[model samples]
Target: MVSRGCCPAKIGELTLWWKGPLWLHKEDADWPKKKNIYCQADEALLEARTVSHVLSTVKYDLSIVEKYSSLLKLLRVIALCRRFMHNASKKERLSGALQAGEIDKAESSIIRLVQASSFTSEIQDLCKSSQVSPKSVLLRLRPFLDKNNLIRVSGRLGNASTLNESQQHPIILPAKGVFTKLIFIYWHDNLMHGGQQAVLSAVRQKYWPLNGRNIARHVVHRCVKCFKYRPAVVKPIMGDLPEARVRPAQAFKKTGVDFAGPFIIKSSLRRNALLNKAYACLFFALLLKQGT
Candidate 1:
């Protein structure tokens, strides 16, 4: 082991290039890029085939992790698992690279089980030392989550749109069909209203709107034949109207009169001219002063 600026890291031979901090990657040619050369400090990692060396070489881990993320440190953990899992017939990647929506459900299921098994001890220890509870593994399985320096929910791929839309519109009411026959008949036949006018008028008078379509629909629904025969709507019981006032001078104003006999009057024009005259009220009481 040798002393770099601060970290006492092991090296093999000082390669003619550089191994920059985790932020800078090989893509940043200026960020301390190195080709195989000389460095003695990395010898321990080389000998151990540790996460550091495998990270540079592992094909699967490199394919998954993005350069710019808090999850970068977890890439080393993935490399370690990749080495351990490589010998098996099944080539398994580590949970650190697990993406939420992007993974197939079946594959995600397996990844979750493996992750739980792999990190069980570390999470327990972290919980004990921090005097706080670790995030629930099951809850973290939620299609979206972001665990710092470990995993991210942003990478998950699945259809959650359908689920989201249903939540937005929960209580959709069923359509209101035709009103019952009884309701229609009662609306149509009331005395305060003229024949069918009473019914139509009543319908309008007591109409209740449905689905924002108002009076037009009310008339339409009340006009149905079945409900029409249901029964004439009886007028509700209200007291009789007050009688009209009549002038005392006007006789027989309300009741018509018939004359019984006529009186004879002589015409001044000629002695032979005789006129039959009788007084009777017209539409209203009228008195004639014929003497003038």
Candidate 2:
């Protein structure tokens, strides 16, 4: 029941000044004489409420390289991660080392990171006393860890003296991983948009991707350059109807229209005349016409 031009009223510790129509001033005080009892509730009369948390578990996505959409961009991120770790270990916020100098190491480190994420169970088994489980996909490849803890294919060529280490024991990669697909694309583009078999063979020289054939096929098929240069499929033209099997029809009822090319035409009869091009539209009855 406040009105304009009314006397000042005390509302708890606040006082509304009446010098103007609407003005409020809080009075300075050590303490309020009366406490607000409406806000206080009795502990015994209060209802008990239980709080429950709904925790949602999310499965980790393996295709992290797909997020960046390019292998080079992902490699730069890995290089940055390496720089961060290097700085952390040294306990300094300053620039530790040149990123370009360690980019090669970062490349290998990124490959290892992808391998770990894709094959957690295999890595764990290899790290522990037990070997990779019998049900593991890597069992068929005879996978063994290298000094850098990367899984590599163990083939009979390991005994060969002339072959290099990569050829003898190529790195193992999961076929479905984005990083592995990017590697396939890299090799495909690097080889001038090579065929599927060629790309697969080139990739196997350094890394043995599981289901490599399918992945290579997919990568080759998805290449824009390869698709652009790929020759158009020539459909076999239908054979013309034989005279004995020809159906009798009205002359203009079964008419077919076709287009003829731009023939060079003389604009004038003079020897040094300008040339022009002309096209012809041909219309013919289907029964009498032969397939071109």
Candidate 3:
């Protein structure tokens, strides 16, 4: 019997072994069973392993990653397994919220997981060194770890007494993250399908997503109601009038008539005579001078 160093990972009753770069599932089958079992990485192992270890374990060539048009999609795939593990491990920190049917808490947990996985490098740098690299995208945000270990914008609003924690130091999130997009969608819906600027403003109240404007624009753009109700673009110049409408014509050929108000009239110019109503009709002739 071949002995493995680490114990196999049990995920939702399924035992999976991570040998080298492949994930092998250990299942009971009718076929001959071998005493040798494969052991895989679990949530604990995943956290124990460093970035270099995980990177080394990846067997795919650069071509596979290059096939993806957007880097965000690639990042999502890499973080998928970790995300699943976190959700499954919800019993630790998020179990109560999940059991209580608190959707807001569950969403917050998911967001926290997203940040932990996506911004691992930045988080590590902030925790270990207390400073982010200049080359990092988060450099401009002046990011710092909050009480919850979540990265937040270290802006100049720290002294504002009226502003809340979220308002003074909003959570930092990647604009391209799926959860981030979902947040934008939530705000868009909550704001009664507002415009991009309005959604962005609402989002900034609690979270600050990188490239937030673009993300908000994308969310608003995808709203079917907004697209349907959007105003049509008006041309600056007027369209050319039809030849029949502008061409010169004979007098009264393209004429218009209007009637003036009724005037009281007297018969035989006598003040006591019977009064009659009379209306005067006026006619407008197009190209009247040319025809005359």
Worst window of 10 by summed lDDT in candidate 1: 166-175
Q: Using TM-score as the measure, which candidate wins?
A: 2
Candidate 3 per-residue C-alpha lDDT over 1-292 given as tens digits, one digit per residue, 9 for 90 to 100: 1133353344334323333323233334633346644333342233243355344442323343345544344445545534457778786532221332343344454556767766777888998999998888999889998776778999999999999999999999876666677677778888999889999999999999999999998888888889889878988988986554578766577765678868988867776899889988876764452322
Better of 1 and 3 by lDDT: 3
| Cand. 2 Cα-lDDT | 0.75
The alpha-carbon lDDT assigned to residue 138 of candidate 2 equals 90
Top lDDT: which candidate number? 2
Cα error, residue 292 of model 1, in Å, equals 32
Error of 1 at 92 (Å): 72
User: What ranges in model 1 sit over 4 Å off?
Assistant: 1-181, 192-197, 209-292
Sort all candidates by TM-score, best to worst. Answer: 2, 3, 1
- Computed on alpha carbons, the lDDT of every model, listed in order, comes to 0.36, 0.75, 0.69
Give the winner by TM-score: 1 or 3: 3
Deviating ranges (above 4 Å) for candidate 3 = 1-105, 231-254, 257-292
The C-alpha TM-scores of every prediction are 0.13, 0.57, 0.52
